[model samples]
Target: MIPLRLKIETDAIEPYVVRLRSFEGISDESHHTGALDAALESASAETAEFSGATGNLRLFGVDPSEVNGDVLFVVPSRGTAHRLIRANSRHNTLLVTERCDQLCLMCSQPPKKQHIDMFPFFETALLLSQKNSTIGISGGEPTLFKSELFDFFNRAMSRRPDIDFHVLTNAQHFDRADLPILRRLDLTRILWGVPVYSSDSDVHDRIVAKPGAYDQVRRSLSLLCEAGAKIELRTVLMKPNAPGLLDLAKFVTTALPFVDSWAIMQLENIGYARQNWDTLFFDSSTGFDIVGKALDFAISRGIDTKLYNFPLCTVPTDYRAFAPSTISDWKRAYVADCADCSLRNECGGFFEWHPKVHGYERFGVA
Candidate 1:
């Protein structure tokens, strides 16, 4: 589901639908070409002079690099176009690294050993992101580049003082030394989306394929709480964790009560997850009652809870409101039965990689 349109706007700039055209595809009347340098070199009377560059090209208030690819859009005012720098169809998540220490069975963006430094790209991305829009920081594990990560956060905070940050980390790398750095940042809106797979340390450790990951994350959570940092603990629901979901909820309510929110999410069938479907996939439709019970218990205890990536048809009516449209639009899809579903507009549907072999038997109109 590649989004056909992207809305780009700034504080004073009216929104514009990002128009794309290749260098060869552009008409003589079109405003842009492949490189910003090329646009400058080949200025003509009919077309608006515009050039495209992946990361460094700066024009019309935006670094074309932040746009990711060739883009054609005009701004009524100068400097206002910078707001579109981090604009993309999916939520604005600046992927900081592909390296990770833990290996979860259902990891979507699995860890890579290759030398891929995203700090520079992220620096430009953070600078270009909208000041008011929530910017997400993600990775195979963001803390791999701790100094660069904290530096980027502080810079982003100063540049876009009003924007909030949502960072997805395993929360295993947080050490006592990192506490002072976290305190330095304006953390009111910096949310750490940490994953805690199970109540048992052994189970949690096994899920992440790390012997002491559970203890590490537990320590990190305590450090974050002590620093007054906002935390959103996430659990990716699957066969291994489903039976213990209620226990995990209880653990959160009792041991980790300082967490701002709890997200029990459906597994996204992609990357390593696709290969491990037989082992990891669980039909939520058949066991929604258990899921609901876990959620109900958490909510009853006044812990903010949310259902991520669960389809409306598969969730109980009582828990429907907690289920947000969680999948990125580019990777989201709907089956034939979704055509007549009452909540189709609000549903997150399934991941594009979810094959029919693993689909739910109870899929239909809600």
Candidate 2:
């Protein structure tokens, strides 16, 4: 089994073998968790120690192994959640901000009015991140951070020049005023994942609960593309957007032809999605025909396409390869029957939060 990416808020990290290491081999004093040789014998959530050559470090139950790497422990808070910022780990994604400008009906992390500056946390995370890793800057909306975000990006890129960034934004904040900043940044490695719900502005705006959002997103995409930044168009499959999925695909192939890739993702049943389940949830077992049509159309047009969070058996054999294991381990789950599935290794399993309102009756051996 692959090693767990990062452990957080757990009472104990013991019994689970982990190779904790810094992005740079050198140990920094700020994250020192000294020698664990003696700490492991009586390790507990309240008190435990991990000893390294650098010094004796105190931490929860983390069983270290001879992984041939220097360890870096990031204690982001006063509490005992030691987040291992794995710069070398492929699953690393920096969640920059939880505040969003758009109130999308199906938002996984709903918008909040609280004023919180997550830059400090992000700055530390980015600095500790692995060089040459594909770093994702996501949020309720990352663009809301504006100049602060740009500064963070600038600093992070300078520290790890080989790092690539993938930012998820609604693209509502992109305009002429932001063009200068966009041009100055290292956008070569940055892939902006922007959402386009539908070609029709009204339909798109309605879904996001922002009246002029569609127009703004359209403008944002054009501006970002003009700035030579790589852009990936995303569309979340749901009831409102399903009817117009094909239309959106057509519009994307024609209007957004410059987009590097198009990702059609399954809905994560959480946050605001739970509130609007009856309205947004569509049983993919039968409703996937529409999705299939849209994917078919996009493929016919030579668009670089990806299907995310989709069950392997639900997608046609031709599109099965396109469905990668997109679900993160923290939230991914598989039904009991999946134990016998030959293609289970290749499939992206269900989200743990799935209420099973739409049963997995369609899932079977491929």
Candidate 3:
């Protein structure tokens, strides 16, 4: 697996963001501010020496090839560095906060009561992002810090209008009062990725371990539509919600017609999902009938439907086109069966922690 955080040595006493620059670009004085010259001498082959206004630092035990041109966050006290934006990666996500309102059964990143405000650092990192990149803003729920989040957006978008964001939220905190600020910002560049597991309010609330969550999401969706905000409705396929997929699709088509897209996603084996694997993991390979029918219904009604985190071989030929390689490069992995497969290059494969023993029963070549 590719590492996102690495141990480093630096003289800085406070946290700061820096974009790694090559030897040639480092000498260009215009790029000195908020940029580090990562060029190293041949004598110190293993250690990458970085220099900038912040001060000189050394990143030991890392090949320069892996992190060249990547944006890094230096936390001096922890002696660790986090890759805020990877140049080679097409998908880059900034986790805004760990605090969330609802506790979902199959949550890959479980909720935490404590939250360290990193919106300022994240705003800096977003400014240094690659041109025209769509950075994903995720969290236990980003809307928890609604005021700060909105301020960050307004400030960042004012300077960097070329960039876009795909925010993952539970849709609980949105209200009519937020409409003025939402309207002032460019909604075209923002896509809210909200979750609605089931059409039935009781079942949906039960899955999230929160009563009235479905109702809040409905209200928020209405508010977003009124503000002309773009939305991507996301549903994670699981045992509890599998049977209701078609019904939820119908609900989306009839009631939530303003949705820009609908994503039927596979469950990741991590956090709460790992603990509830047996109960929550739905093998869509064997249960593709229901999933496919739901996709068909949504697509026929003009919804841009997609399958996220699904391997190509597990999907039927007719629906394979809908399953793109949506997994991020850092955590994505492949099994031995994919070694000689013709579509290996195009497949998203699987999450690094996906169970090999009790995984899909029909995993093989497409």
Q: Provide TM-scores for the models.
A: 0.80, 0.83, 0.95
* Model 3: lowest-lDDT 10 consecutive positions: 34-43
Q: Looking at model 2, report the run of 10 residues with the lowest lDDT sum.
A: 33-42
Model 2: residues with Cα > 4 Å off, grouped in runs:
1-47, 51-57, 65-78, 82-84, 357-361
Model 3 lDDT tens row, 192-299: 999999999999999999999999999999999999999999999999999999999999999999999999999999999999999998999899999999999999
How does residue 349 of candidate 1 score in lDDT? Answer: 89
Number of the predicted model whose TM-score against the real structure is largest: 3
Best by lDDT: 3
Question: What lDDT, from 0 to 1, does candidate 2 have?
Answer: 0.71
Query: Candidate 3, clashing residue pairs?
Result: none
Q: Give per-residue CA lDDT, model 2, range 24-137, as digits (tens).
A: 334455344323212222345454444443333455434433222322333324333333344334665666677888898889888776756666656655554545678677
What is residue 69's positional error in candidate 2, in angstroms? 7.1
Tell me the tens digit of each residue's lDDT in model 1 across 1-366: 553223332333432323233244445786544322224323233322333342222233333333343223334354333222324554656667788999899999988987566555455445444447787788888898889889988876787787788999998788999888989988897999999999988888988999989988999999999999999999999898899999999999999999999999988888888899888988898888778889999999999999999989988787789999989776889988789888999999888878876467666789
- Model 3 TM-score is 0.95
Q: Which should have the higher lDDT, number 2 or number 3?
A: 3
Ranking by TM-score: 3, 2, 1
lDDT of 1: 0.74
lDDT values of the candidates?
Answer: 0.74, 0.71, 0.88
lDDT-wise, the better of 1 and 3 is 3
